[model samples]
Target: MPIPKVQKLFQKTFFGIFSMFGVIGFSTSVLCVYTVDTHLSAEYESNSRDIAKTIADSSVDILLNRDLATLQSLIDQFVEIQGISYIYITDETGTFLAHTFVPGLPEVIRQSDPSNTDTVERNLPGMGDFVEVGSPILAGVGGAVHVGMDTGLVALKIQRAIGQQIYLFSTVFIIGVFAAVWFVNLAAKPLGELLGYAVALAKDGAKAPPSDSLLRRNDEAGQLARLLLHCAGFTDADNKRGVAAPGEAR
Candidate 1:
């Protein structure tokens, strides 16, 4: 069966309005995710660098004096810090002096590349992701303190942030779509009423709604209704004509 005119208008308006909301919600969600992820990653990286630098500063005197016991204790304390993979110190000749791990001390640090004042981010074969920071010890010893921090926590934090954004945006999108559909239907109400008035006039002649109510509206629907009322020309004498055309009824 062919759909009624009012039904067609309602469907078109609801879908058109809802589709616009969907596009807006999707773009907003994507932009929010990108902004949040970038901010979180940068914060994690900065924190990791700061931790590495602090450990280097504390280890300076211990490393220069070759105080193995004190150096070992410091390394163990730093390793207790959350997200620190390991803290190790090397001699001027690149020989491991003390370390947090129980392997005693390796003859050589396989991934050691010490910089004078900065930390470098790198991905090692077995270590996953790591930030390698180095600082020089200046108590008459010519070695550097190296701290390796794990980046798993950074990735984990980013993932959780994105998940939260997904939930938040999904809720907003759903509410927006429903609200858009509702407003569109509300706006179409007068048109639907006008269509009903026209249908009734075609079938029931003088039984249609009074012209005064529609003429009060001042919109296009009101104009159309007024035209229909003019054509019908309801009159007290026309009632005796028993629903015939206006001219014939007169």
Candidate 2:
């Protein structure tokens, strides 16, 4: 048998709801993460620039005097700050005066600009991800201070946010599915009742018709129910008319 109009409507509505939620949830999650990541990136750059400037201001006097102990201690203090991977200071000739690590200076330090600070992400062999910030000390005349900060924590927070979004979206999707099923059943109820009534009439013409509750509704389903009830009565009237016609002709 062909599918009923009510069933078709249910199918279409369910599909539309599911598809719409899927797209909206996915797009919202992606946009939220992207927005957060962008903001975090900007925060990282701003924070690094500020920290580097602070270090530069503090180290300029000691750097000019070539006080290795004070510079080392100063850089060491800043290194203890959370998320700081390493900090170093270099002289006007690009020679490192003090550093938290003994590694050779990166080639970029030679080209460092004092007027403008710079930050870049580096993926080292053992390090997952590190961002290096450079600031010129003494207005580029004294030297420069470079700081590297760990980014794993920021990434972890982003992941946590994404997880929360997933959980929230999943809960909403489940509720929506259940609601769709309920609404479909509610919408199809009148049609179901009409079908049952037609079946009853087919089996036994003497059976009483459906109640007027459905016919009283203002909805399309009520209209259809009213039409079906009218057809049933019309059919009975036609039968009686045929019988009376034969009797009248005789």
Across 76-148, the per-residue lDDT of candidate 2 in tens digits comes to 8878877777777777776667877546545454355423446777665554577888888767888788888
Give lDDT tens digits, candidate 1, residues 1-250.
1113456766776677668767876786677667766776666556656765665677676665768898788778778877778777776666667777544433235544443436677675555777666666653155667777777776676667767877886797778778866776665666666776777777767475434454456667666655566577866554443333222312
Report lDDT (CA) for all predictions.
Answer: 0.64, 0.71
RMSD of each: 6.4, 7.5
Q: What TM-score do all the candidates reach, one by one?
A: 0.69, 0.75
Best by lDDT: 2
Which parts of model 1 have CA positions greater than 4 angstroms off?
A: 1-26, 101-111, 115-118, 125-127, 139-141, 199-207, 210-223, 235-250
- lDDT for model 2, on a 0 to 1 scale? 0.71
Estimate candidate 2's RMSD in Å: 7.5
TM-score between model 2 and native: 0.75
